[model samples]
Target chain A: MIRKHGIKLTSVAILIAVLVAWEVLPTALDVPRFIIPTLSDSLAELQRMWANEGLLGHILSTALYTVLGFLIGSLLGAVMGYLLGMSKFWEKVLSPYILALQIAPKVAFAPLFIMWFGYNSMPKLLVTVLIVFFPVLVNVLQAMRTVDRDLVNLARAYNLTRLGIFWKVEMPSTVPNLMAGLRIASTLAVIGVTVGELVGGNTGLGYLISYGGGQANAAMVFNAIILLTVIGFLLYVVLERIEERVLHYLPKAHQ
Target chain B: MALEFRNVSKSFATQGDGELLAVDDVSFRVEEGEFVSVVGPSGCGKSTILSMTAGLYQPTSGEVLVSNVPVTGPNSHVGFMLQKDLLLPWRNIIANIEFGLEARGVPKADRRARAMKELDHCQLSGFENHFPYQLSGGMRQRAALARTLSIDPEIILLDEPFSALDAQTKLLLQNSFAKTIKDAGKTTLLITHDLSEAVLMSDRILVLSERPGQVIAEIKVDLPHRDQPIRRRVLPEVGEYAAQLFKHLKLEEKAA
Candidate 1:
């Protein structure tokens, strides 16, 4: 118990030290405020933005788009993965096009989406969906391919229908991989939304950072970046909790 | 006959090797409630025979019949078990046992009661809520057996079901399984490399040659207390039966 407490204390200490350095180092080294703002300056800018720049609206917009994109992308990916897994002919026929799409950097599509959908939320949502889709699809498809053949044979021997086999055996077997893919996509969802917002968004935390940069206010930019990180971190934590609950039956590795 | 393989031969199409024969013209009959084991050297297609009996594999030529009907596809009348427990790790023990029943569309309450009874029969009563990974290897195999028995299949096809266990666990499981199967009067066909296991539990043993397996020898185990495998293990006749099977397999291996 003490060792556990010790580990927690060490983490806290590291966080405190980083905060102290952020506050103290800039002025101690006589660095200009525009180059590397002190922690106080960033915090003041955060308060000012809260009062004047509708900061809550930006945070909520980014969070909303991140969640919406994640849900839609995950659903699309899972459906496509199962469809492809079930039909080898279609999987073979479509693999080349899918591969080409996957190979191209997802962030590079942000500009194209913006061009097609204009500067509205559509581009950001589309970009987030694109970024989140591939990881889930790849992981689920790989999982479907490697499901235990013996188990499937056993199910067949019981005269389970093809749908029954898929529902009972194949689907449950791919869950671990599916959860893994979702976790990866959760983080990527944030990157996707940020890229879209950076390219053309007029609202959201990404827009705030871009706007702050244009105004040469490093402190405002720093505050927006910190808020964005918090959003991503919260999403990751939520996914991890869900994973723990869903995979409770799986044995944990020995510490 | 509960199970019959009439001149069944199985071959697979290899990528570059054309046709690869596994089992060649094997004929056998398993009477109702009889415990038969097919013992062979490695790669002798012992598993292929079980798969065909389960209707998972079609014979390249001839036929495998269960309860007088030729097996054309996966058969509802057959229960198959393999070396791996193959329990759904995400499911608790009772849920795993209920899998086959669920597939057959048994009512929810009926499935639970039958699965619970099998769990008790297999001596896994307290572990019903525990997942497969939480159980010991012996207990997991017991759950697997419960899963198979829950389906109430006419013929149980076992492909090296106990081969993965340690010697002690294997013997214990063999004794438990023999008693359970005998009490249920289920027709069981076991595939194994262990001659002693074949001799201990089976009423009759079929010895197959190496790859392109044929039923080279058939031994009738005329021993008392066949249901009690542990008791039968110490009998002088058991050793003799094992030795005979070993000789058949060794000779086949040498020829290969």
Candidate 2:
């Protein structure tokens, strides 16, 4: 009611300007084709992929690994995060291992995963799960650990049991933070799958990019990049919508 | 006995430090359905005494008996409200009110029934769907009061409950609470810094001293119990009674 849509308008204006600049810059500089192709070339490549029947199959195959990894990783992260947040001892025990895994370049780990899981979708799925899991766990744990103590005390004083305390007090307070972690995790899941595929695979957006890159087809590479970005952004937007709908009660200061 | 605290003295000892007595030989009793407000200089552990009454702490060497039963932890029959209303933001007005009922395992239909009844009593009926963020400070505090009552506890322990409200809102809420509780005939122990509130609403006022809070004075309020606010506000006796409590607090402050 109080000028709620101000940010949306500003974001739209900035996006329009960026798109216009992207379309015009190559022509102004007389840039060579296949080196840094025009946005139109990338768009054309996208349309061609769309015209081909199984482009969606490639997208869907890639999507399968991403989604499966996201759901599994997020669930594990939330549960682990809750446990870790509640108990300092477990956090001390496991968080270091988690942090170590997080800092390890996931790209380098993809080859070892292929050797372990096979060169098909499983390695890519594992990579996606690994990429998305840490942030969700870390963010949720921090949120749960730092919940307002006075409110907890109030609940305790009112004869609320431990289970009651969790549902009524802790979960609602931790949600917005948890949702942010979920959003970050979702996009990273996509990246993980593609990275895994690029390392070793015969299909998916990652494989398509590899196929294009090896042939020095910059237009094809940019085309794949554009599609990947759209996939990531669209997934991010949908999850964000879910987050917004579920956590309408949380204050904006939450994230 | 309705409630009793016998020779309950408490002190805290820190690492490599001498002991500090917070309440020394504090003792008190109140009859059922009686309104008693504990007043003192700010650091006199008036709140500690309230905590003791609510079974939040044990007096170092004494027993706190509520309805002749010793308090080991937060007593099931006692409900507490603090200076600030601690309403959960995620729950709407009705859900916030229903939280205690949910904790106590009341069925959803029954909980809704009770919450509806409480809403009518608190005059918050149509606002059940509004979240805490949508409500004013006074409304949130009223919702908190409703939450406390929903547990259906026999005794209510208030720790400086109105200290956060604007003076006008505080007065209004005290009047509202006084009227609502009188109809329900519930026992209440109110701890407040405001002398006039204690004088205006309580049956007896326990004035306490600094550091180890002790009952320095007990003043019985002999005001009319037809208890209409309009008439009570104009009475000359109200001013004199409030002044007496104020003087005792100041004297206790100087003594420490």
Candidate 3:
């Protein structure tokens, strides 16, 4: 119980310690302001960027694209995973295509996507979907395929139809696997969005990181990376909590 | 007819042995409401015989008849409970029992009532809402039996049903085995490796040779089917009969 909230405190402490070190060490070393900005210098830069420019809006803009891309990618992956799993013939035929897509470098398609959808949210969204779909699809399909054979045979001896077996047997057994897949997919979805933004996105965290690098504002690039990483962490933790609550009645191992 | 195996032969291709014969030219008749058992060594293909009877696997050279009609595939009127209870964890007891009805496309309302009736019959009325994981192993087997009986199958094929249980539990279960079949007016064919279980529960026991399984003998059990297993075990003649069956099975085991 004590450890439940310990993670949050530990994260805050680590951030404070890094900032304190960043603040004190630069001044002590007499490093130039541009070369190694102090924590105070970074904060002042943030404040000026906020006041003189639409920097905060850009951050929010990037977040929106990330969230949208992730949602679309994750939902489609889950649906297709279940559909393919439901049919053996379809699984045999379509699973190879899905596997090939998963293994084929997602970035290689980025240039092709730019040509097809152009440098906008569409290309970024497509890239995000490509990255996010594989984890959920693979996990969900495996979960469905690997139901206890005895249970299925039992159902059959009772003369259960395919639909009946699937609803009462296959789906429930796969839920733990589904949750695991979702957890992984949730994190990957963010990566997908940012990658899409990096290659062709105009209004996401990916674009900001690239824009910062192009302008030689290392501080802004660091800030974008920090914010994105925090968002990714929060998304993962939140989804995991939801999975736990939803699967509370499920049998758990003595961890 | 309670159960009939008409010159049944089951053969499967082996890696090096080429078309390994499991049960060859086997014919047996079980009377209506009779409790019959087939006892053999581990590789005697007792399960294959049971599976053929249940219509899970087909006999290569013959037919299995329950009440005269040949069984080609799974029949709704035939209940099968394997060694494992095979209960779906997601479903509660009532729903698990109703799985048969769900497969048959029985109406939801009727299945609910039928499930309740079965639960009451199995003395698991209060546990209808409990999951398989929550129930005791004995209770789970009881529920599994209820699930089988719910479909009102005339012939129940039990393949190594008590093999997974502990010795005390197996003993307890073996005691109830005969009474339950008699009380339900259901003909039962139990396949087991335990000689005592076959003698204790069966009205007639089929003894088979190992590997390329063949019916060596059919021994009649003269012990009366009683309500309690402990009392059944204490019967003076029961032990002698079990010992006789044990010697036959053991001799075959040594030869194999």
TM-score of each: 0.98, 0.90, 0.88
Write candidate 3's Cα lDDT for A1-255 as tens digits: 678689889999999999899989988998876677777776776776678656777667656766676677778887888899988899999877887889998867777888998877777778777787788888989998888887877777777677877877888888888888878877876777777778876676677778877987766676677778877887788888998876765667764
Per-residue CA lDDT of candidate 1, range B112-200, in tens?
99999999999998999999888989999999999999999898888898988998998899989998999889999999887888888
Per residue, candidate 2 scores C-alpha lDDT tens digits across B59-83 of 7888888898888887568888888
| Full ranking by DockQ | 1, 3, 2
lDDT of 2: 0.83
Model 2, span A52-131: residue lDDT tens: 73568778888777888999989988988887887889888987798898798876779999999887788888888878
Question: Which prediction has more favorable DockQ, 1 or 3?
Answer: 1
Question: Candidate 1 has which clashing residue pairs, if any?
Answer: none
Which RMSD values do the candidates have, in order? 1.5, 3.2, 3.2
Tens digits of per-residue lDDT for model 1, A58-151: 9999999999999999989988998898888989999998999999998898888888888899999998999899999989999999999989
Candidate 1 lDDT (Cα, 0 to 1): 0.91
TM-score, A chain, model 1:
0.97
- CA-based DockQ, model 3: 0.54
lDDT score of residue B79 within candidate 2: 81
